[model samples]
Target: MFLTKIDTLGNVVFSRLLGSATNAEAFSLAVDSQDNVIIAGSTTDNLGDNTRISGTDSFVTKFSARGDRIFTYQLDTVAQDKPAAIAIDADDNIILTGFSDGAINAATPSNGGRDVMLLKIDGDSGQRIDEALIGSATTERGEAVAIAEDGNILLASIDNGRAVLRKVDVNDFSNILFEQDLGQINNSGAISGLRVSGSNIFLAGSTSNSGFTGTAASIAKDFAGDTDGFVLKLTDNGSSADADFVSFVGTEAFDKINDIAVGASSVFVVGSTRGALEAGGREGPTDAFITRIDMATGAIEQVQQFGLLLTNNEATGIAFTNTGPSVLDALGLPAGTVDRIETRSVDSQTTAKAGDYFDISIDGGRKRRITLNEGDTFSDIARRINRLSFRGDVSADGSNGKLVIRANGSASVDLIAGEGSSDLLGKLGLKSQRLLGTDALFNLNDDDDQNSSSTESDLGGVFAFKLDGPLGLQDRQTAAFTLTQIQEAINTSQRAFRSLSPSILDTLGDQLGGSASGVVPTRLQSQLANYSAALSRLQSGSGGGGFFI
Candidate 1:
C-alpha cells in the first residue's frame, strides 16, 4: 500500500509503500477538512503486524498534508472484504462501501453471500463508528458511494445484475432511508454511473428491452438496438414513487453510458456508441456522444458527438473546471463524539477440569473450540480466550471471578457456547442468556436478570446496544490461533496426556503394538522392537505414525 503526493506541476513530494510482503491495492481516496488524505484499500496478509487480524481485509489509512503517515486501520469481515468506494461526511467520518461474505459487526450480520457492506470510521482514532450489511441472498456489488449534504449516505450498486440505490441514515447505518432498484440489465446492459444532485440522484446506465425496465418513466420504450443508454432521475428524500424522469436514447447499434453529470436544469450523459445514435445527427461506426436531458420533462435536449475519423473513440469522463469549488474540496466533517462500552460479569463457578473442552459461537459467527487444563483458573481461561478476541475482548472479572466481555465500540457483544459435554463450561457456569443493556453508559446492576445455563453445552447470549455511530467488528474469518499458537496448543495437549497417564509403559503401549503379544517373558524385548519401528515411521512422516501413539 502506498500514498503518493505531487504538486500541480506534477513534482513528486513524498511516496510511501506499506506491507512489503503482502499483496494490496488502493481503490479509493478521500480528504478531510484538515488536509489529511484518507485512502481505502485491501491487503492479503496481516500487513506484517500481529496486532492486525488476518484475512483478505481492507484498510483505511490517513496521511498528513506534509506527506507524513498518520495511521492505518484494517477493516475486515468474515470473508474477503473489499472497499470499492469511499466518501467523507460533514463530520469527517469516513464512509466505506464494499462487499463481504458476511457481516462485519454483531448487529449487522451477513444476510447471505457477497452482501453489500457499509462502514463508518472515526477520522481521529481510526476506529469504527458504525456498520451495516445490506443485500439479498445472492451477490451484490457496491460500485459507488456518495455522501449527502445532511450526512446521509447514498450507495449505488448492481445487485444480482440489477441496479440498486439506497440511502442510509447518518445516525444509524442499519437504518435504510430508502432502497430502490432501477431495473435488471441484460447481457450487455449495466449501471455505469451515479451522482447526487441538490435533493435528487441521477443514475446513468444501459439496459436491454427484452427483459427489464429500461427507464423509470411510466412510458416504456422498446429496445432500439442491441442495447440502449438511459438516464434516470429520482428524488433522494425517501420517496417511494418512480423516478421523476427516465430517458432512454440509442440507435441500431451498441450503445453504452459510462457517466452522468447534473446541471441546474439538465442532466448530461456520456458514453460510447458503435453505430449511428439518434441523439447525435452524425452516423458513425464508433463515436462518443454527450446527450443533455431536460430535467423536468425527461426529454433529450441536445446530442453532441465528437470523434476522430477512421478511428475508434469513446469518452469515459468529463470535467468542468472553474465552475465552482471542487466537490472534493468541500468534503469534511467536524469532530464527532466518542462512544464506548465496558461491561463485567461473573461465571457461577470455577471448577473446569483438565481435558474438558467447549466450543464458542459469537453472534452467528463460526464456532471456536476451547480446551481447559486441570490447573487452569477462571483468569487463565479468560486470558486464553481473550487472545482470540473478535468484535469484543474477554477478560477475567476479578471482582466476581467471572468473564469481563467488553465491546470496544458501541455495537452489541454476543457469546454463545456450542453444543458439547465439556464439564469445564459447566463448572464455569456458562449460560444460555444474553446481555441486555443500552449502548449508553450502564453497569451490570441488580435490575439485570441473572444469566445461567442448566445444560453445560448451551452457552449463548446476545448483547444489544444502541449507540451514536457505526459499529465495527473484527471479522471471524478463520480460527484466531496462529501457527505458533496451534503448535503450543498441541504441545499442551501432549503434556496433559502425559501427566494423566498412569504409567509410561501404558502411555507407549499403543506405539509398542499393545504389549508385544502379551507374553511376559518376551514382552520387554518385543515392545522395544515395536517402539523402534514406530519411531522410524514417525521420523519419516509416514501414515498412522506420530509421537503420541
Candidate 2:
C-alpha cells in the first residue's frame, strides 16, 4: 500500500509505502483534525510485528502530517477480519467497521458466519477502547461508517442481502440507539456510503429490487433497470427516523454508486455505469459518472461521464475539497486529460408495423400471441405484453430503441416467432430465445474464463446453427427474401460477442487484433467474409439463385 500527499497545485508533498513481503491492502482512510492520516485495512503479512495471526488480520496505522509514523495497531484474530470503512469522531477517536469471522480484541463473540465488527480506538494511544459485533446466524457485512451529530456511530451494513442502518451510542458499543432495514424483504441491496448533516442522514448504495419504492416524491419513482444506484435521505427525529426521499438512478445495464459527498447545496455521487446515464451516450462499455442532485428536492442537477472509448472505467471514491469534488477513478489516465467524443442524435422512429405479431411464453407454459395494430408504438406493444397473464413485465427502451422483457417471481421468459401472417420476431431482431429472470446478458461472468472450454463449445454450437439455419446465409433463397434475416443474424453475432467474458475478449483482441488487423482466425474470417458477401448480394439486384460462400 502507498500513500501520497499532494499540495494545492497537485505537486507531491510526501509519499510513503507501507507494506511487508506479503500482501497488504488499504480499504479506507481518514484525516484527523490535527492533520494526522489514519489508514485501516487487512493484511496477510505481519508488517514487521513478527506476530502472524490466522488468515487475514485487520490493522490501523496513523501517520503525522510530516509523514512520520505514529502508531500501528493490529487486531489479533484467529479468523479473517477486514475493515471496510473508517471515520474520525469529534475527539479524533477512530471508529472502524467491517466484517470478521470471529471476535476482535475479545470484545464480542461471533454469532455464526461472518459478522459486522465495530471498534473504537483511542486517537493518541492507538489502543482499542470498545468493540462490538452485530449479525445474525447468516452473513452480514459492515460496508460504511459515519458519525452522527449526537456523537453516535451510524453504520451501514448488509444483513442477509438487505440494506440495514444502525445508530449506536459511542460510549457503549453494544447500545443500539436506532436501527432500520432500508430495503424490502427478499430484495438484495447494499449501502456503501453514509453521511450525516444536521438531522438528515444520507445513504447511497445499489439495489436489485424493482419494487423499491421511495417514501417521498422522487425524480425516478420506478426502478430503471438491472442493479440501480440509489440515494436515500432520512430525517432523524431523536427517537425515530422518517424517510425524506429515495432517488434511484440507473440505465438498462449495471449501475452502482460507490461513494457520495455532500456539498453546500447539492449531493454529489460518483460511480460506474454500463449504459447511457446522461444526454451524452455511454463513453464505452462502462464509464465513470459524477452526478449532482438537489439536496432538498431530490432532483438531478447535472451529470458528467468520463472514460476512454472501448475501455471500462470506474469511480470508486469522491470527497468535497476546497477546489471542488475530488474523484478517485480507475481510468489510469493523467490528470486533466480529456478525450473529445463525437455524438450523434437520432430521433426515435417507429419500427412496429401494422399486423405484426409475436408469441411469448413464460416458463414453457401456454404460448400467448401478441398482435400489433396500425400506428402502434413499442410502448403499445409493451402494454399488450403486460396485459396478458404472463408472470413477467415488458418495457420499451426509448433510448436504445429496443424492447426489454423481464420475468418476475422466479419466472423465465421465452420469445418465439409467431405463425403464418403473424411473424414479427424476425423483424424485431430477436431470435427464439429463452432467458431466466435473473439472467443479464451483458453482465461479464467471471467464471466464464475458468470454464472457457464449455463456453466456447456452447457459443460455437449457437453459431453453427445460426450459420446454416433458414435465416442463415446458407439458405440463400429464404434468407434473401428480406434484410430482416441478415439483421437478425447480426444481432445474434452481437449477442455472442457480448457473451464473452472481458478477460477472454481482451486475450482475443491482443492475439488477433480483431478484424481491423486482418488477423482473425481462419474460421471466423471465413464466416465474416460469407456474411459480407451475402449482404452485398442482397443489396444488389443479382441475389437470385446464387449460393453464398
Candidate 3:
C-alpha cells in the first residue's frame, strides 16, 4: 500500500509510490477490510511509454498488506475529461467518479461543460460498469461518488452554479433519487468538493451575488466576502436542506474550496482563506487550512492549525482511520493527529491490544461490560446503555462500577477499576445496553462466571437472564449486590430447589409467591431471607470483607 507519513517537523517521512505510476495516469485510493490499499484513478500511459487516451482515463492498482503493488488495471472511455474521486463500497466495489468531455450519445448531449461519470468496478477483476452522464450537463462536474448500503451509487456534483446530489441505481445507473442545490447560494454558486456519511452529503463550494438576498431565513444573497469558502450539508438528494447561514464561509477574497472530509465527530474542509469566519466558520490563511466542524451541529471547532507558514501547501484528498492515534504514538507526533487510509479488507476488524490486570479484548471478538455505581437506579443503566446486560453486581470496594457481562465460558464475572469509560464502549452501538437487574445476578446460564459475548439477539442481552434459565427472570428491585451476594443466592436457590423437588411454585411459595401480596412478596421475600441468613454467617468472626471466598 502507498503510505504517506507526515512527521511533527512537517516533513513527509515516507511517500512510497506503489505499483506503476503509468505516465499521465492518476490513482485514487481506498482501504480494504484487511487494511490493504486499493487505488482506482485513471491511467493514460503504460510504463511511462505514452498517454493511453486523449483525456485522463481510469486506472486501478491493488497493493499488498505491506505496501507492495500487486496488480494494476487501466480502464478507459472516449471522454475528454479525467477521473476525479474514487471510493469503495460495502461490497468492495471501486467507484470511480469524474467528468467526461466527449458526449456519450448513449446518455445525452452531455452536461454542457462536463458530464458526471460513475464507474463501478470489481476490486479483484477490475470488471466495471460505466455510468456516464449522471446529472445535468450544464457545467456539471462530478466531485465525489459513494456506494450506499442498498447498492445504490450516490453522486455529488456541481451544475449551473448548484450542487447536484443524487443516488443512481447500481445496476442501471439511473437516478433513483436526487435534489438540486445544497446551500442557499448566490446565483453564482458552484459545488467544488463533496463528502458523504451513509447517504448524507457534504459539499463545499463558492457563491457570489450581485443582487439583494434575504436574512429572514439566514439566506444572504450578497455575501460578505467575494467568493467565500462555504461548507454545506446535503441529503441523499441534493437539496437546499440546511439553514441559509448553515454553510460556513471563509474570510479571504476569491477563496475556492478544494476537498472536504469527515472525521470522528468533525467535518474537515480545506481551501483558500486569510483566517476569517464567514458563514462557513473560521479558516486558516492561504497556507492550506484544515478546519474541523462538529458533525451533528455543523459548528466550527478551534483546534491546531497545520502549515500556517507554508507558501503553497494545498490540502487535496482526505481520509481517516482509527489507528491514527496509534500512528501518532509511534511517530511521536502530537495527539489528535488524523491519518487517512485508502482501502481496507472486506472484514477488517478494529480492536485494542489487551493490557495487563484487566479483561478488555483487543480484537473485535471480545465482549462488552457495563459498569455500575452506587445509587445507580436499575433504570439508569437500562435507559442509558441499550441492551443492558446486568449479570454481575457492584464492586466490593465502595466504587459502584460493577458489571454484568455475558458468560465467558465460566460461572463468574468480575468487575475492577481503571477501565476507560469511553474507549471501552467504542465498539458498542449507541445506547445498545439495557438493565437486566436492579442488583447483582446470575444462575440463568450454564451456572458460571466466565462471561462471553452472546450475539444471539433474543438469547443475548439482560432480558434473557431468567431466574431459573427456564422460568421467569430473577427479581432485582434493590441495591446492586456484588459477586459474593450473587454466589450466595445461587447456593440458597440451589439448596432450596434441590430439596423442594425442583419447585412447582408451591415449593417456592416463600421465594416465588412469598407469604402475601406486596412489594416484599414473592421473589423479594426469598431473596431477603437468603440475604439475611448469608449475612449472619459471613459477618460472624473471621469473615474478612464479608467472606469473599
Candidate 4:
C-alpha cells in the first residue's frame, strides 16, 4: 500500500509504502482528532507479527501526522475478508464495516456465503475491542457506515438484494436498537451513502423498482427509467424510524448514486447517467451529474451534467469543502477543454435533378415554390432561397455536407412544406420545421430522408420511356439510381428469368433473340449489359447515360 501526505498547495510532504511480500489493497480511510490517518483494507500478505490464516485477511494501519508508522493491526481469518468503509467514533475509536466469508474473531461466526462484518478497535493501541457479523442464509455486504447524534452506530448494508439500515448500540456489539428494510420485497437495491443530521438519517443508492411511494405523508417522486438513483430521509426516533421523504432522480436510462453529502440547508448527491437528467440532454453515452435538494422539503433545487459526448464520465465520490460541494469525476480531458454537441445531416445528398420543386413558407409568410434546374447543387439551393427574401439566413455547410437555416436577429424561422409541393425538400435532405427564435440553433436536415423519392421517380421515368419487357415494369422503374439499388434490381431480374418456364423463355427469345437454353437471349443480354454499365458509372460518380435506370 502507498500513502502520501501533501501540503495545502498540493506539494508532497512525505510518502511511504507499507506492505508485505504479497499484494495489499486499501479501500477505506479515516483521520482521528490528532490528524492520525487510519486505513482499513484486505491483504494476502502477512505483515508485522501476524500470520495469514488462509485466503485474504483484513488489516488496519495507522500513521502519525508527520507520515511516521504508528501501528498495524491485522484480523486473521480462514476466508476472504475486506473492509469497505471506516469511521471514527466520539472517543476517537476506530470502526470498520465490510464483508467476510468466515469468522474474523472468536465472538462472531460466519452465517453463510459472505456476511457483513462490523469491527471496533482501540485507536491508540490498535487492539480489537468488539466485532459483529450480520447476515442471512444468503449473501450480504456492508456498504456504508455513519455515527448518529446519540452516539449510536448506523450501518447501511445489502441484505441479499435489498438495502437495509440498522442502528446498533455502540457499547454493546450484539445489541441492535432499530432495523428497517428500504424498498419493496421484490425490488433489488443497494445503498452506497449514509449521513446523519440531527434526528434525520439520509440514505442514497439505486433501485430497479418503479412507483416507489414511501409513507403516505412522505414526499415522493416516481421512478423515471430502468434504474434510478434515490434519496430517502428517515426521522430516527428513540425506538423506531419514520420515513420523511423518498425522491427518485434519473432519466430514461440507467442511473445510480455513488455518494452524497448534506450541507446546512441542502442535500447534494453525485452519480452517473446514460440519458439527460436536466434541461440540457446528456453529453455522452454516460455523464456525471450533481443534484441539490432542499433539506426541509425534499424538493429538487438544481441538477447539472458534465462530460464530453465522445467518452464516458462518472462521479464516484463527493464531499463538502470550505467553498462548496466538490465532486471527483472520471473525465480526464485537458484543461480549458469545453464539450459541445455538433449538428450534422444524417443523409449526405448535395446534388439535385431538374423538375424538382418544393413550396416553402418562412416565418408564416406566403408559400413560394423553389424549383431546381438540371444539375443544381446544395450551394445553388441556398442561393435561390436567399433570393426569396425570407427572415432566415440559409447557408450550405460544405464541411459537414448539410444545409443550415438560422433565424435572423430575433425573428423566428418557420419552414413549412405545402401539400402541393414536389419532392424537392426531401431531395435537399430537409423537412418542414420551425425554430422559435431561440438562441439554440437548429439544423435544416431531416434524419428520416435517406433515399430521395424524386431520384427514384426519375429512374423509374427513364426506364418506362426506354425499355420494354420485364425491365420496363413499373416496379423496376421505382428503383433508385444507386449502386446498391441497381444491384438489387439486377438480382431480382435474374431470379425471375431463371424461374420462367421453357415455353415462356422460348416465346421471349422468339420476340427478341433465338435460342432459350443455358445462354441468355440477345435482348435480355443487352439489358443486363446496360445495367452493368450503369452500375460501373454510379460507382465511379459519373452520371449514367440513356439507359441509367
Candidate 5:
C-alpha cells in the first residue's frame, strides 16, 4: 500500500521496499510540474531493503523530477502513529498529515495511538521543515493537507466529534492563519480526503446523518434510495458559509465517497452508488460514480455513473490530465468543459467621438457594446456609461476631454479600445485586433431560437460589434487615443487580482503535492504553478524557462 506511479501502460515506476514482510500503504500522492512524485502514509511495517524502524512509523518519500526514488525517511514520535495523507508546495516543499499517537520523541516516539500531526519536508531530501500537532490534547484525525500560494497550509481533521479545519503558516509553522469547525454532526466520521482550489476546500467522505440537523439552506438527502455520500466544501477562512460551504449528496441508497481531487476550477469525487440510475441505458443496479463540480459556484456540471454490470465496480480514485476530453469525460464532466480554454480573451472596441452623441446596443440582452461618435458630448457618453453601470458593478473611466468610453457591471473584461479609438487605431492595431477578436469569439446562441436559426453556435449566444469612426466622423469620427492608457487602466483595475490569488495558489499547491497513490494531478498542478511562478519571476526579473515553450 505504498504510493507509486503507473505509466499509461500501467507499470509501477515506484514501489518502495517494506521491512520483514510487512507492506507499505501509500495513502496519498502528489506530482509536481517537474514530474517528481511525493507520497505519504504511515508505515506499520519497517521499510527500506536493509534496516527497518523497530515499530510502526509515519513515512514520506520523494522521487526525482524523473520519477526515480530520491530519498525516504521514517517520522515517528514518542507515540506510535502513521500519516494518512501528504502534499507538496510550489517550492517543492512537502506536507504530510494524519493522526499521531500523541508522541514527541527525538527521532522516533515511544508511541501512543492517533492524534492529528503534521510534518513538512523539503521535496529534495525528505528533511523536516516544520511540524505541528493540531487540536487540544485530545485525539484528532487528519486526512488531508493543502498549502496556499503565500505558503499557508490548510489541514482538515476530525476533532471534537466532527470535521475541523485549520490554516497554518508554511514558514515557521507558528501562527495560526484561521480555524473553524466543518458541519460534522456525526459522532466520529472520517474526513477521508481534502483538496483546495482557489479559496475553496473540497472534502469527501460518508456520514451517518439520519436526522436533519444541518444549517439553513442545507438540504438533507438520503443516499441511493436510503447511506449518503457526503461532500463538503469549506472557505479558506474555515467558516461554515459566506462564500464557502458547498455540499453535494448522492441519491443512490448505497453511495459512499472513496476520495476527492481538486483541480484549477473543479473538484472530482469518486464513489459508489446503488439503486435506480440513468447510466449506460439502465435504470437499476449499482454503479461507480464520478461527479465533477464547478469550483467557482460549486455547481454540479455533470455526473458520470459507470459500471452497471461490467468495468470497475465503483469509481475508486479520480485523476485529471492536460490531454483529451475522453479522460475529462471519464471524470463525469461535460465534454467541452476543458476545451473553451483554447483562449478566453475578449475584444471589445467602443466607438469614440469628440462630439456629444452616444449609443449602446444590447444584442439579445446579454451582450452589450457601446458606441460614441461625433455629437457624443461628454455628458452623452457619461450618461450612457452611467446607465450601463449599475450601482454594484465596478466601472472604469475611458474618457478624457470629450473623448470617453469604459466598462460597466463586469470585473473581467478586455476594455482595450472599445470598438473605435483613433489613437488606438494609430499607435497599435487595437481596433482591428478588436474586430478580429470579436469575429473570433462573438458566437451567438440563436441556433435554438427560430429568429437566430440563421446564426451560429457550437454553443449559441454570440454577437459582433461594428463601431462608428472609420466606417462613417461627424461620420461618427473625431476622437483618438493610445492603447497604452487602456492597458494601464486594465493593469490598474486588475491589481485586485492578487486579492483572490492566494486560494488559487493553495489549491494548486495541494494538486502539485502528490503523496503516493498517484502523481497525475500533482504533475499537472506543478506544470501550471511553475508556469505561473516562472511568469511571475520573469516579470520581477527572477528568471524562467521562457515563453518559447
Candidate 6:
C-alpha cells in the first residue's frame, strides 16, 4: 500500500510505500478527527510486525497528520478479504466495508457466496466492536460507503447485476434504515462509485441501457451508445417514495464513469471513454474525461477530455471538500427510502397452488390482502404483489425457494396467511418474525445460524440434540434413564428419519391418504401419540417430570 500526502496545490508533502513481502493494494482512504490519515486495503504478506498475520487479509493503518505511521492492524479471515470503502462515524469509530467470501469475524459468518461485510473498529485501538454481513444468494460486494448527516451509513453495492443502496443505523447494527434496488439498465450496471450530497445520492458507472427497466416511471430511460457512462441520483432520506433520475452520456463509444463528487451546484464525474464522443466537448479514443452536470436538471453542463489519441488515461477515484446548497431541493425531495424484506424458505416448494393469499401489513398499520391468481408462478405472484404501491416489492429468493418483499421505507412489514391462504407462511417455512422491516440480514444454511437464529429461527425449524459420548453420565445397565440417554435416543430417531427413503415414505403416505397434503395420517398420528406418551412415562420414570438415575 502506498500513502502520499500532497498540499492543495498538488505539491507532494511526503511519499511513503508500506507493504509486506507480497503484493499489497490500497482500496480506500479516510481522515480521522485528529487529522490522521487512515488507509484500508488488503495485504498478501505480513508487515514484518508480529501483529500482522499472513494470508489475503484486510488491513487498516493509521498515519499521523505528519504522515508518520502510528498503528496498523489486520483483520484475518479464512478466505480472501478486501476493503473497498471506509468512513469515520460520529464517535470517531472507523467503519470499513468490503467483500469477503469467508468468515468476517467470530460472530459474523459468510452466507455462502461473496457478501457485503461492514465492521466498526475502535479508532484508538483497531478492535472490532460491531459488524454485519449482508448478502443475497449470489455474490454481493460493497463498492462505496458514506456517512449521512443523520449518522446513518449509506452503503452502495452491486448484487448480481443490479445496483443496491442500503442505509444502516450505525448505533444499532440491527436496524437497516432502508434498502433500495436501483434496478440496472443493462447487464453492466455495476456500482463503480458512490457519493452523497445532502439528501441526494449520486451513483457513477457504465451501463448498456439494454435491459434497463426501472421500478418507477419517473426514472428516465435513455440509452446513448453501446456502453455509455451513466449517472443516477437517488433520494437518500428513507423517503425514497418515487422520484429518481438517470442520465446516459456518451456518443457511440465505450464509456465507463469511475467516480463522482458533488460540488455546490455541480456534479463532477471522472471517467474514461473510447472512440469519438461528445459531452462538454469532443473527445477522441482512449482518453480521460471530466464532465460537470447541473445537479438540478441532470443535464451535462460541461465536459473536458484530456490525453492524446490512442493513449489510455483512466480516472479511478474522486473527492470533494464541499457541496453547496442541499441537492435535494434541486432534484426534488426523494420518493423516500425503500425497505428490503429478504426471506428464504427452509424447504423447497416445487409447485405453487392457486387461491393462496397473504396479508401484508406495513408500518404496523395498513393491511393489504393479496390473493394469487390461477396458475401463477412465484415470479408471477411477485410481479402482482409489486403492483401494489404500498406493498413495495416482492421477489423470489433464487438461493432458497422463498419470497422477498421490500417495503416502501423502513416500515415494519408483516406477512401472514389471509383467510384461505392454505398455511402459506408454513408452506414457505416463513414466520412472522422474518418480517425484516428493520433488519436486512437473511440466510438459509447453518453458517449464519449464530447471528440470525434469533430472527430467522422460525423460518427453519430448530431441534434440540446432544452430541455423542456420555461425558456426564455413567454406564447405566439398569432401569436408570438419564436425560442424556433420552436425548441420545431422540437424536438417533431424528437421524433415522433423515436417512429414510423419500420415495418409500411417499408410498406409505399415499397408502394412508394425504400423500400430497404433507399431513400426518390418522394411523401415524395415533402411533406418534402413543410413542410420545411412552417417552413421557419413561422421562417421569414412575414419578412426575423427573429423570431418576
Return the top candidate by TM-score: 2
Report RMSD (Å) for each prediction in the order shown.
23.2, 30.3, 28.7, 27.1, 34.6, 30.3
Number of colliding residue pairs in model 5: 68
lDDT of 5 by residue, 119-222 (tens): 87877766677776665655577777777545578787777567666777777665777776665546545566777666666667776664422232443233
Please rank every candidate by TM-score, starting with the best: 2, 4, 6, 5, 1, 3
- Evaluation by lDDT, superior candidate among 1 and 6: 6
Best by lDDT, which number?
A: 2
Off by over 4 Å in 5: 1-21, 48-53, 65-67, 106-113, 185-188, 210-226, 237-245, 263-265, 277-286, 308-312, 325-549
lDDT of 3 by residue, 129-246 (tens): 5555655545666776766545576677766555556667666666455444453454366555656676455666666642222122333222456666666554443323332334
lDDT of 4 at 434: 64
Q: For residue 428, give model 2's deviation from the true position in Å.
A: 65
- Model 3 ranges with Cα > 4 A deviation: 1-22, 25-27, 47-55, 103-113, 135-137, 149-151, 183-192, 209-223, 235-245, 275-285, 303-310, 324-549
Question: Per-residue alpha-carbon lDDT of model 1 for 1-549, expressed as tens digits?
Answer: 456765433455555554323477887777788878998888775431233455788788776666555566786554788988788888888888888887776867788888888888888888889888888798887777887645688888778888878888888986887787767764355666667777777777887654455345553334576778877777656544257666777777778887777787987888888876653445445899888888777778888777777778888765343334445334532122222221111111222324556655444456566776544455666676666655453333433545554443333335555333343454455654443223322222333322222223333343222233222334221122133234444444444454454466666887777766655657777989999998887677745544444
Kindly provide the TM-score of model 2 when superposed on the true structure, using C-alpha atoms: 0.58
Cα lDDT for residue 29, candidate 3? 64
Model 2 agreement with the true structure over 83-190: per-residue lDDT tens digits: 999999999999999999886654478888889999999999988899999998898989999998888888888888777888989899878998887765133666
lDDT of 3: 0.50
Can you write out model 6's per-residue Cα lDDT over 117-194, one digit (the tens) per residue? 888888887677888889867888888888876778888787777777788888877688888887764445656766
Global Cα lDDT for candidate 2: 0.73
Against the reference, the lDDT scores of all candidates come to: 0.64, 0.73, 0.50, 0.70, 0.54, 0.65
TM-score of 1: 0.51
Question: How far does residue 226 in candidate 2 sit from its true spot (Å)?
Answer: 0.6
